[model samples]
Target: MRRHTLSTAVTLCFAASLAAAASAPSEARPASPPASQTARQQARVPVLVDCFFHPEVRPTDFVLACGDGNSRLTSLHWSRWGQASAKAVGVNIVNDCKPYCAAGRFHSYPVVVRLDRAQPWKKRPHLQHYSRMTLEYPAGRPDTFPPTVTYPLWN
Candidate 1:
């Protein structure tokens, strides 16, 4: 009789445990992502130009936030980067160095940005850098002192 009662109690407890488990919520599973999202993840990543002050994050048509409020590089498209030269087209913004740099008018000039001896950036090994930036302004530039400008990589 004791054995029968013990067996009945065990069976009842086991059944109650299963019922509680069945009533509980199941664990969540992650849903599959959309096809478009997967395609975009596989697409080629764009490269960005190093503007003066701001850190380069991603490729952009305009070179932005150089910290110089009046001047910026824009419409930049880097075509090729060979050992000798890297070709690009953009517009250069030159602020007139007036009584003070702060109170100066800004001007935009069409330019071709060329990079020679392109190499990997020191700080960011993955990113590319040029030994120098040769800006060729086809249109007339503003009448500022030291009109011709070249940006050096190491400096």
Candidate 2:
């Protein structure tokens, strides 16, 4: 009986310590790429994000033209979910057509964004950190106006 009680207490303490260690804080800045980006980029390189809600499928194959900003870029290329590692996707998607749009199972946004400054956001202008573009499908079918994939990045 005494051995059983000691074993139980030890197990509980070990589990609690593991949980706390997992939650320790880490530095926010530095390169931050979504797992999918490299895989997809190898198959189909990122070209450009010309405009938001562009009427037609605007190809992003021109992103190289966008130039690397002063800060080193950390690309995030993921689908609606990041759990499954990014594999090359079907379709040569042009995000310019719908940069901020939610349409059939897929929603897209521009991570390389610029913020207007001199006020609320900052005293100076800034680029948004490596961000997300969502592509969701319900039961393997596209979700119209797919809800934004939720991720929290702290600075």
Task: Kindly report which residue stretches of model 1 are placed more than 4 angstroms away from their true locations once superposed.
Answer: 1-67, 82-84, 145-148
lDDT of 1 by residue, 1-155 (tens): 57455545554564465456446554432344575763353232222345432223223343333443355677777786455566777777766646445444457888777667655666555445455667777777767524456776452
Q: TM-score for model 2?
A: 0.18
lDDT of 2 by residue, 69-88 (tens): 11111233333221222221
Error of 2 at 143 (Å): 42
Q: For this target, which candidate reaches the highest TM-score against the unseen true structure?
A: 1
Candidate 2's C-alpha runs over 4 A off are: 27-155
Error of 2 at 120 (Å): 35
Error of 1 at 116 (Å): 2.0
Candidate 2: the clashing residue pairs are: 47-60, 47-61, 47-62, 47-63, 48-60, 48-62, 48-63, 58-94, 105-142, 105-143
List lDDT for all candidates, in order: 0.54, 0.27
What are the RMSD figures for all models against the true structure?
A: 25.5, 17.8
RMSD of 1: 25.5
**Candidate 1 residue pairs in clash (backbone atoms < 3 Å):** none
